[model samples]
Target: MTKTDRPDGEDSGHTGPELFEHANEEYDAGNYHRALELFDQAVKKGISNEVMYNNRGAALDAIGRGHEAVDSYLKSVSIAGRYELAWHNMANSLFSQEMYADAVGAYAKAAALNKERVENLSGLARAYLKVGKTGRAVAVIRKLDRFTDKDAAVLLMQCDLYIDAEELVLAEQCARKYLEKNPDDVEGFAHLGNVEHEMGVYGKAVDSYEKALQLTPDDKELWNNLGYTCFLAGFFDKAIGCFDKAILLDPLYKHAWYNKGYAYHGADMLERAVECYDHAVAIDHNDPVLWNNLGNALYNLGRYRDSIPKYVEALIVDPDYDIAWNNIGNALEKMDEYAEAIPYHDRSLEISPDFDYALFAKGVCKAETGDLEEGYNLVLESLDLNPSYDEAWGARAVLAERMGRLDEALLAVEESLAVNSEFDEGWTKRGEILLTMGNMEAAEASFQMALTCLESSHADTAGGLASVVRRGEVLIRLGRFEDALVNIETVVLAGRTNSRMILKDLELRRFMAKYELPKALVEIIRKIAEPGIIAECAEFMVDAGNVLEAERLLSVVRGIPTQSSKLTKAQARIMLAKGETDSALMLLNTSDGRSSDADLLVINAGAHEAGGDFSKAADLYSSALGMDPSNYAAAMGLARLMIRSKKADECISAADIAIGIDSREWEPHKLKAEAYELLNAPGMARFELAQAHSLLAGTGLRPEDIIGG
Candidate 1:
């Protein structure tokens, strides 16, 4: 991203020797400004040369007058079109002005006239890319390959261009080709790593980056990028090392500092993360993202009051950032000021009226205040904005689950993960849905994978009420009841009442305590009615400990009237709490098969299994799986039931499906192990379990989860 400019040289001199000597002296003195004046004097005295114009262009560029520098370089080329340096300088100037077409033509002419010079070819190729002629750029480089002249800068230039064009494949090809001949070219290796990463080939990227790092261990940008890449590739420890190296290389590298903070934040190293963020802020006081990240880290670390100022600082830097406003709203919400959070959400909506994320946040806040009808409407708007947003979908799934729509909840959560497999919250939420649907294996895996990815992805976290609750539910499923309680307490620590997770967590606690509560569901029975518990409420009878009672209640509630979501939610909450997942699921299913109500459906799947109908529940979970091949939650649940039923074929299929849906979730591997175990393949099962263990080790997971009980 360098620019070239013309020098201000004085050409006033008595004779050839004195004049040239004085001019050259001025140029060497780092006095491009003065040299330009001298060069001008000499030109006026009838002593014109291409060197003067080329040198002037470089000088002008140094002084930040790049457009003018292009003019000077063009003049030099006009004086001597065969001058390679003049053409190179001209190309650089044109690039500064984003005049790529012109730059390409000039550089091409220079290279044509002097095929021996590598810079001309490289410059032309880069310009060609900038002008949207990527094929031509690669072709030019291919031709340049036959030339005897080559330099590190030449390879690096092409690397930058290829990366910009999103031609990672081509970039890697060229980089590998260049490295074969120039084995010690650190820049080449570094560029190759970047390309590999862009292509989603993280293992290759890591290898290339390591080679480059070995050569230039002190290169800050390389280390920073490598660290971030590793983080994305689910290798947190390696990412941390790279980021740490980058920070060590250049203490002021804000990106490096930020990345290091993210790594620490993912590791739950709150104090260290805060310190890293502090360093980043100190280095770059104007970056809103850094401030937002800091706010999130603070919030995660239980520094609610401290998070507020960071969000405020972020807003100060980027007043129009909807995400920032959303963050501020979240902080306010955590402080027990739900009403205060509303203003921030309103501001966010003003900036991006159709932003589903903001709308979802707004709805959640409204819902927290007991504005169910209005909140539900806003949630619908959020789904319309981004039907695939995991957060929004998960929210809808929870709602559907509450409404006794297990099938719909599963489908909603699956839809959410389909949009972004990296969304750990979605994975965990999907796991809960799987559990309700009698898909214990997949559900367990979802919970495991969600926690694993959350600790590995090193990305921004969503601070939603449901997000916290999903984690608590996963803990409960794992039989870590105490840990689940602790996580639920953290939800309360956020001071969020009326949070779906809080209600569910409380209900889960009660369920575990009562061990056998009546499935009367008096509230839902008195409110909404439906038919065919399979499509209505069959399992409701089982949950009430009277297999016949849920059936009878289902028949009675069939006339309860749940045309709207509010009534439906009451019924769903009953089904979900009572374990009548199928009855709950049908409440939210749209006639056309399209899911507008995600919350209810996901919860339906969860309640179905909890109610004791494993097979029917698995089918409900499968509806979501059909949409997304790699839906971790559905896979986990399906595998569990398959194992219990000794359906080895289905167990293996579920595990395979979960992995395909999202490799970031380690649950599928565990499920696969169970499938092998049921097939009497202990060796294969152990291997599968080991793989899961390896994946979860760095994710802060306990060892027991990877191997079956």
Candidate 2:
């Protein structure tokens, strides 16, 4: 008779054996309630034993009463310490409950009581692995050879162990070995893919993962692994497809969403990237990396102000996230909020002292905000920390330029180019520095190199406008006026405008007027006129002999009735154009002599030049040139003065300087022609005249109209 059906007394009719039989029957029929009641009766009727407790524990575990099941198994094990089944049952219950430490102890007890059985040892190894006790897990797994001597299951566990140890070669070997024995193991292939991915063999990883998916197509994680491998392989579109499959299978899969965003970003599909990252952040808002990436995409779009808040949110999640801190600093720096950017960079440095980017960013901000020495030192320190950092070297080059250290700037930019010749902006930097140093040939080569790099990619080349403009300026100096006009006109037609637009517009007007294309000059004057360089625009109109348009443009600024020196100068230049020298002098004298503005000095010199006071005009033009070395107007004024005064040698020298400054202007070439005539060199004189005529080929002006005495 079973203990559950034992007779209790006269008050209880059923014996323990009958009750136990009923409980067993109910348990087999899946009636846990009836089984539990019968088991309780058997135990209350003084028929309790380890087997009965073990049976009850199983019923309890099946009914989702894991805590109660553990207690029952403990009761069984306590009653008979040699009950290996009871110990094993308790360990399984504890493992199900996620009480890994207690599960390990119980599994160890079971193994000891059952002569170290394979089942108990395997359970113990899994529990140890769960709790991150890898050493203990390894020891327990070694005992599993009795049951899994040649089985793929043991190989799989070893694969996981080696992977955890970051021994990719061993992990890959085990995964492949397992697949050798169990060719149909879908997970084994996935594991092998994971190992290959860690080893950076993305193509092989994709092959392994594809095999795994073919066997078990619904595995979301396997799909995710394949997608990540594709992303690493630069097959961004294919990666997106894999991620889409994973997302379709599990809508809440955060990693898949996040990875899809990166794939889109890699493909330069920024809007799609932003959408994916936004969805990911919505699902799992605590992931700081997601917020950081979203910020990066915004920054890339030139939405610097908008990117700040996203970076701030990331910082809130993890205050020590150095990259986010550095990113915020960079965005602020771009906005010209250098003061605000400095602290964030400092915070990043505090978190990671060796962070070269943070150092470089802080250095740039400091340099911009007038702390040059400290900023230069910081930038140098960043370069020292990361010698191959091309961007830092670029920053150093710019800072050196700001400090009037052209030689240093050139050296730094060369270092930057050497480190990363493919970086387009580095070439642009080299061109700018060389242009400033008057190395026209080298500067043109650098700018052309940058253009090649820019055209080969979809990168925004508009930011390299200065290089384009500078290259045209050099071409003009080389007497390639037609080529120069084409280059500058292409930039204008592409609808890009900046402060340099004024200079380019001046170049265009000079070229058109000299080429006798009065129509082009009129159109350009109308198109390029804006408040920032309105006065310069008016002055260019006056130089083109468009005095009426110059007066109209100046009238707008003059009507403001403010203390306007540029307006005064533009009006004076126009007055001088109409041969009204006294009116021009009166207008110029309204300004106090305390000012030494380059344009003002040049205008004053123009008044003297127009009045035929060549000597006085030469002095004023020389002063303007002294104040501003790149003053093309002053250079031309002095050149013309030398030609009219019959100083042939001085005329040649001054005209050469003027041409060096702005080769498109016809005045300097005309001045040189007059000088060559005085020297009685008709061949050279005719050459100069032809050069001057070529410059004025399109403009509706003649050589006699400009340089006639």
Candidate 3:
């Protein structure tokens, strides 16, 4: 919008020409108001020329009268349609007024008149960018680059334009060229850093940002950028230090606080991360990311109920925030409210159908609610969308296992571990599957691997305590009593209420007594006063041959003034262990008169068998099987009774049912061998015995132990 030169040799006979010349002088002296007054007077006196109007427009523009300046430039262009200066001035004026579309037309007209002018091309490129014509803007800048003689400003502008267009390689080229010409320019280094960051060359990004900081050490933005780059590069501690420096430079910098939270969260310092997020939200409550991050920190802390409000706050700020919706569902799912959590995930998927996390979450909820097939398909769909989603793979494995597709479950879990070798849950699931398949050595190795992963995670929270409990179960299974006790002690010391039930486990109690743990630790376990846990502890004591202690626990359970099938079962089991068959049957019959529970039926069948009522025992076992075909105890019990009665066909049928329930159990195969021997099928007997021996290989059981039983 610079003023054009005044027309030479003005009309000396007219006062208007003299006034126009004086206005140009005033404008040259930087007196825009006075120049505009004289120009208006000259225009009133009939001085209508392109140069006069263009110069007057510049004077108006200099005084912040953009609309008036545009009108003056239009007048100049209308008087002489070929005036490039007037067109360029009007384009600049229109750009200042945010009329980008109109500015593009004017700038294009100016460029058409003077193809060699850098100002016209630059203005046109900027207008194109403003109008979202990024490709056109790029083309214009490339043309401008040919004759700009490698201008530093033009190079920097081109770098920024390329970055806006997401042409990172070209952006990097322009930034590097700018730095080549302006070696110490902070902006040049910053642009290079941005380009490297977008390209995921984190090391180079860090170096460039560091150089920019050296040039402008007081720039908080440079420090923040360096911190985020380090965060993306997995340098959490270094990222935190950079964020600290940024906060020191500007105490109220919200992004610094937010970024510091992310660094802490990445490092698993969840409480500190929550503190930083609190500060961030206090500074800017409208920012959904801050609220969402606060929710995530709390969720990771096992404060699922507390996290819901934070996620709700994020939703309040941005109802369309799909991540927040999914997070809310995850929190509810953690609370075991799977049915309630499904609609939240559904809403998230509605908003963003390709949100794989939401799809997987909904799948988990469906599986928990007994829709195994539907859950499996949903998880498969999520895996199809994100092939590397390890959690989804793990969920699919669980569903496959539940559906009795054990081999498919094994392969799916292996796939999960393949994607993330350190996935502890995947290792844990692999161990459970292998144990079910009777591969004791491989199962132990898998559990050991799972423990290794959990130990390396360094997560000393509720989830960590749960992992410790899982490790304790593995240790107990592997007969590592000392290690199991150590894990139990860790959980007990953590004082998590959920550990109370785990402490009452039969094997865990045996380890506690065998290791002679302190009475204080014993007293900690005894503090569990819930009726259900007390009853379960009683049953555990009965199984451990501590009938007197079992009776004591049952008394406590019975005093709760509530009807409990568990209480009845525990009392009846204690009676049966004492050889009081009549008392056990009377208690079971009275307490579960009309109940059809398969486990209760199995217990009743055992009581009848102990009393030598083979007829009632066989009928009860058959009824239990009819109620639940997967009841291994009932199936084995029926098979043993059939063998005693010399009913080889019934024994083989019952043995087959037991085998169908769990192919890994050697007892069924051993019973089938005896059935075959009774029928004089020596070859079939040998084959069944071989299967039993194979299953019993590492179980410290000889062929006599299986055959004699």
Candidate 4:
């Protein structure tokens, strides 16, 4: 409310003074339009004082005529150049109009004239904040603190100023002080909640919001705040319930819908997440974050093709949305279109060069396409940008392992686990590296740790099933056939429609066949009836010396509709195992050329070696190694042929390569020992023989069986 001044001595006997007095009464009675008419009549009757003009401005401002109000204030100030009240009223008008710089000047003038007025100083501070002069705003707020009897609203204003300046401790103090003065003020409690949330004390923030809501339960904004705090505190169900309350209060609240979706996403209820996100997107179709979250839910559900279009819509809404571009690249990578994924990542980097997620994602795509060194370097850059990125470190470990830098890979994976000990994928990769290095006990421990983490973090998810399959692979290597069977059955039951899981189940079953397939296992395979699984089962039977059963399984699969490359390879392998080498070569020659598949090339090399063509066999092995340096069979096969040819140096080199591929295989160590013996290096031969004996310790291979007993 504006103060009304009595007229000076010159207007003492005029009708204008009486009219002005009546207008002031009308203003006091809150009839602002009536007051303005009376003031105009007074001015027409020749009352031209600063007080009359300032009163007129206040009436105009009260009637929502802001520009006219500012004009009247300026006239009052021009009449009496040092009128403090007129300056204050003008500053208020300017502030309302968002002319913050002009407001600051007027507020400063008013404050200069009356240093004790809280309104003048507070208005100046607010204007300074509007103009981003935070230091000046803080200075003004400190001056306000000098007054012991401050208004409660002023305290709340100071609290907001402190929060904007990131002085959270001071902000909390102010909020608490305001709440103490005005115990039932919802704004005070809301301010306290905001301060606590900024401090990351989410539980305290939730309590504050709950208290505020008790005062006004219908406040949808308060409900949303409480829900978000609960979400941050990891109370997903409670957060969802709060969001439901907010939605009930206001069905069109898009924020509540989005928050509910995010809570569902955290809980891994991805289908429910998609539902909430879809509702949010329908409410606000242009919100890029809602679209992006919808895409993420689809991607998590393994609907990569479906996810890509949602990300595209997000990009359409916000062309500079870097995360959406990165997500599209990720979906393509999931589809194994690595070459097609790189450009999307490139576009993301162009938009945000320092985005570490894009850098790491691009690095993975490069690694999948056979550029191990470039991939490793990109991962290093991502780590440099954000050293705490645990997944990037895991990627570095895998790339280093593929490049045969085993020691570096070990160090890299250790760093990854050190950063996040509960990272299941990191533990899984570490186990794989340890298995390759022949540290079987340590590898088993790592796999067990991985399973523990997966059980806690990813239980009942597709990711959890994948981790289980990896642990099953480790169990198979350790010769724990029954334990591996348990893992296989778990994945087979849970992920029956997943082709990758089916392939892993086939591999586990093949390894278990080394003993004897259980009745249950045979029944499970018979129920599957997949042609590829049947062909692989036939190959496994032939390897286990059950050639009759192998032939019978092969004949059954031949009647199936599919004629896959896997079936052809299995036929050629069975022929080679039966000593029909020429028939095996003819069968492979007639099949479609899959020369790029390292596994297929290794099989082809075996056929050539069985035909007694040592040179062609070595060539095929080299080609397979070129295709995939991690092909353990090709490395060992090349070393065996070199040993047979009496090329001791070449045999040692090839055996070293094979050992690098898989140090756990005792055959490579024995071949190295034989090579040393041929080279007349008796001491080295003894060392290599010791390695082979140690690696084969529990396998019934005596010291004499390894040579040099």
Tens-place lDDT digits, model 1, residues 263-370: 877766667788999999999989999999998887775456778899888888888878888877877776668878998899999999998888988887887787
Query: How many clashes in each candidate?
Result: 75, 20, 0, 0
Q: Evaluate all candidate structures by whole-model CA lDDT and list the values in order.
A: 0.68, 0.76, 0.80, 0.80
Candidates sorted by TM-score, best first: 4, 3, 2, 1
Query: Against the hidden true structure, what lDDT does model 2 obtain?
Result: 0.76
lDDT of 2 by residue, 202-308 (tens): 99999999999999999999999899899999887789899999999999999999999988776656667788999899998898999999998777655678788
Worst 10 residues of 1 by lDDT: 700-709
Which TM-score value belongs to model 4?
0.63
Which candidate should be chosen as best, given TM-score against the real structure? 4
RMSD of 4: 11.2
What lDDT tens digits, residue by residue, belong to model 3 across residues 392-455? 8899898999899999999999999999999877887887787667666687688778777767
TM for every model, in the order presented, reads 0.51, 0.59, 0.62, 0.63
Between candidates 2 and 4, the one scoring higher on TM-score is 4
The residue pairs that clash in candidate 4, if any, are: none
Winner on lDDT between 1 and 4 is 4
